[model samples]
Target: MALASALAIGLLISAPGTSHGAGPRDVAGTRHAAGTHHLASEPGSPRTVSTGWSVPWGLSWLPDGSALLTERDAFKVYTLTRDGTKRQVGEVPNVVTTSGEGGLLSIAVSPSWNADHYVYVMHTAAEGNRIARMTFDGSALADYKVVVDGIRKNTYHNGGRIKFGPDGYLYATTGDARTPDLAQDRTSLNGKILRMTPEGKPAPGNPFHSLVYSYGHRNPQGITWDAQGRLWEGELGDQTYDELNLIEPGKNYGWPRCEGSCSTSGMTDPKRQWPVAEASPSAVAYADGAIYMAALRGERLWRIPVDGASAGTPKAYYAHTYGRLRTVESVPGTKSLWLTTTNADNSGEGEPGSDTVFQIDLT
Candidate 1:
């Protein structure tokens, strides 16, 4: 595996609580058209809330406002109430998760979850890294099947983010799995974002006519759609920098060959980047024209303003105070965000707890 330290073999900069990219308006919810939105900064302190978990990663808010969170080590998804009460929904099927960054990773509500009650998960299945759908009947699940399989695997770099895009299709992010060369291989699912249907087939009209929606990624964990339906993603870079990018379906995002800002003539460049040591970005939330990030090593929530396709400077908050942040979800019907921490990670810096969830008011 190409170590993040390997990328830092040369002159690598390190700081904490910084990241790079965002949307249409700005942080104050001002509009570019009406001039209401403007750039937002984390000048004020973030009000933190403790979730109380063991290594939380991805989280999805159910229709009833309950949440479902995945744990990388536990290989289980826990259902929690608004008050943070917890219950073990069930275990991820067919996973060994024995070392090397493989395990139960991320979860997404079926775009049709309201009707079908299906939840999709991305995990290190025994068959390999794969995507699967399981039905949650409030207490337990009965139907679980592999929707998509055959991603590369390794001890680390198992990019395992999954979400339902605004287009009503399923999208997944993959890690290079230490196979830098595979990132350049379109035929390989490693290091790419795949777009698929509910049944796991490639979405129709895809540029590749295959599962790949975009390629040339290292290991991306954060992905969200802007109010305008444009897809943006947060990525972790090796030695040099960490990044946030405006995604274009089918675009190549210069990974192993390029880390921070892409200067290669044809490859896409990140909208923003930070020196590695300080920030290891994990998840993102796009709200009111600003992108909110959860950082693992940097241990803060980063705010980046979006003017359009490009982004402005980034601001950081709660540095070294929140431990290792894993995921940031924009709470529906509110200006606040739902933030989850990752103190239990074997690579983290502190003691473990419930991994706390914060309801932070962007206002």
Candidate 2:
């Protein structure tokens, strides 16, 4: 077991209308089921589930409960079971690394996988970033088809995470691609949360009449649906603040115009904001009435209790224990989470194959 760090840092949660500076410890009207920020199934000590991974970026479970995992730099995919058995399932084709953040990234299994064996992926390619679909029968992957393309790609901000929302539409997060202006342009796919059909068409009922579900995002990497099927997102701010936003369709999350919280009309503010030093959040997963956010630079896990549209005080866990966390996914049907590390990547501090996945049982 990895040891938790001795440095336990306390961070005040920033309110939506507050200034860029830090706010009080708790948001005024936030409510919790347990009358506090802690979850009933509080996270226990982590158990190492698997090892020998290099920059594992995305994870999605098969109908059988075995998960499909992706290695960012290597363009490979593997199937990992709860028993810690792992096997290479396939390798994504035509995936090119930006030598930075780009490569084969997030993957999502078809919600109706038993009927249709389709798996979706978002990766950086030669022309740009593309959301593609492939056939994953049980053991291998094939039949590569591009679902959406033309998303801009830069070395650092290729915001790559995809999921099939409770509404049965595919949702993807794209970065600003180093050009912050693209965030505000609804025509561009970059810096937007895109909602699309399983075939890559724009999802019906979308506010913009296009794939753009919500616009004006800087580098949003994490997206998840709460118990009420409400969407939530985690975005990486440039220098000042990182955000945990309650996502709404057609809303504008001010990027170049506003970083954390601003009085800018028509722009939606984050539910909670944190200093960039504490959260370069890569992925978020909802389980047991809270959202588990995996931190990259912060090297920790954050648990934020949620009640409807309001968020409570944020709590840090496993601080500095794992090197650089890249992904956190709630284990379906259980009060547990599967967490991955990105320490093998360029910005991380560990060597190749130094990353591992831990199963954190919530007690």
Candidate 3:
């Protein structure tokens, strides 16, 4: 459980698109390593934590172990306690939704929240998508300041997930903004995993001499660090594939050029890949020696085991049982995971406030 260098580079394996227990059959003709396989039983069911939510998008814990949660279209932030009590804290101002995906998206309580009382959020503004900071006194929010901006926005592809890494630096995921070529452009902030200081400046030792930590991502929406401080990401691919990548500084995850696994030189392959039909992944959380990826189109939670740099076969849980999983987050000091549904979102076809949050206890 030692922490690795934040800038260290590593490689992961490739896996096929398979739904282990429920829904549909495994996708054939997808390229993967020989040893990648599936398990038979499904993970246990989750206990409902709360209900009546409308598109809850992000969840991050405060110093006291309670979590701060965000609603995408409402521009509202709420605090959820351990006993299932939910209270509205504040609403992010100047936020605009694309009527599709953009709005108040991700939240991360500053690592030094005890001293700084700072909270950060990624949201869509009039000009573009922004990473902003504000004061959270454990009771209310105030004093907003824009830390990072200029990430282009689109109706559907505005990638938005942010977390403070084990290195104490801020890391964010971004989409290509519907422009495929931008994923390959190192200069563009779109389609990249960015590591930055709390003040929005590029972190030291970044490969590109800029904020970009890794490039060539299509619409990456999930990122988390393992017990060893290795970063993992989940992305939405085009028509063919979705990706679960073991992130490394300076590496390029093939996007427009390669969908899943390809022999193309210089572009890194994913630790696991799934057909777009089986995995439109959103948020990923690391817990109990595995990465739990929340799937949208697949409507399942994928648990992929990890050992150092290698990823094992993915196992699916709660397939089609909880309409459109959106986010999965590890509880700070427990063997539990908090999961959210996106059933109230535009693509879900459910009534507003139909979304819910659940706690999945790992054995």
Candidate 4:
């Protein structure tokens, strides 16, 4: 696929209730000619909600419009109100942040959170990468329990994104931990997408009859379902390409054998591929028939329109305007997306206290 044409437009930068850094500028909606399906060029600026975060990695929304956020290096969780008031919830115990990309990564509030009050987190521990459950009492997180463990961990490629599917099952993406061969080893938990119950058991009807749902991933950090309940993933590749894949049951996404796309039999090709420098894509979210992907190395937001299982050409937005976007999530019951920046980390161009969260309107 060819790169989408760039539109020179202006955006309105806004910061609500806080006077700090600038938000996205040059807000213009992409316009398409009649009956044409193309990437959108209208990219609007987001509103800065909060700042002063240290490599914030995960974001999950509570029932009452509050958000739970995790800081990767700090091993701390915070609750941010809609008005941008942030309060420290609690620190995750025994988290190992020594490794480069290892630390507190992703968070998911249970579908039955109102009743169970359970919040799930994926973090790096002394043994390896693990998923743990903690109880949230509207104030703090307690009763930390390790739900799943033994995922390989390394300085990089500890694929750390977790979310609940529309079917109410928990899904996790794991890296090969720099061991590329592990991506092909289905028996190993690394380099694959795992579907399991909230209790850490394999979800029934999984294609492999094991925890592995799909294998042959390098380091997939983003997973979200489209309106048709089909899963989409954003993957980080080696030096060649970054991929946006449509995930299927028991399928193999060619990793070591193929980076982006190949004619190899039985290996699923990516729906879209971009150069590594253009898209070290991280977390993704679906909203209004399009998948929004946050790019770290690219330092931009990508919006790809999805029709059924196929994706159209992707358009880049906010390119290099913000340093290192880490997560993008759709706000439930609204046409908004919550984006978090990962500038405080080693790979970013931000200062010590330079991470932030922004609210973007897609309407």
Clashes of 4: 6
Give, for candidate 1, the lowest lDDT window spanning 10 residues.
Answer: 5-14
Please identify which of the two predictions, 1 or 3, would achieve the higher TM-score against the true structure.
3
Model 3 regions more than 4 Å off: 1-42
Report the C-alpha displacement of residue 254, candidate 3, in angstroms: 1.2
Score candidate 2 by lDDT: 0.84
Given candidate 4, what's the lDDT at residue 242?
89
Sort all candidates by TM-score, best to worst.
3, 2, 4, 1
Alpha-carbon RMSD, each predicted model: 8.9, 7.6, 5.5, 6.5
Which digits, one per residue and each the tens of the lDDT, describe model 3 over residues 233-327?
99999998898899999998998899888889998988788988878999998776677889999988887776778777777776776778898
Which lDDT tens digits does candidate 1 get at residues 1-363? 111221111100113333322222122221223223365323222344434577878788787867788888888888876555788889887876847468888899876776898999999976679998999877876588999999978888888999888788999999999889888899999999999999999999788999999899998888987666778898888887788888997888998888866558768878777766557889888766677777887876777766667665566766777678888887666555677877777774545564666665543
- Tens digit of per-residue lDDT, candidate 4, span 1-363: 221222111121124432222332211221221122443333455688888989989988898978899999999999998688999999999899855889999999999999999999999999999999999999999999998998999999999999999899999999999999999999999999999999999999999898999999999999988766799999999998888889999999999898888879989988878888878999988776678889999888877777766676577777777778898887766556788888889874777678888886653
In model 2, pairs of residues that clash are: none
TM-scores, all candidates, are: 0.86, 0.91, 0.91, 0.90
Q: RMSD (Cα, Å) of candidate 4?
A: 6.5
- lDDT of model 1, residue 288: 63
Instruction: Please count the clashing residue pairs in each candidate, in the order shown.
Output: 15, 0, 0, 6
Q: Give the least accurate 10-residue stretch of model 3, judged by summed lDDT.
A: 7-16
lDDT of 4: 0.83
Q: Which model, 3 or 4, shows the larger TM-score?
A: 3
Q: List per-prediction Cα lDDT, in the order shown.
A: 0.75, 0.84, 0.84, 0.83
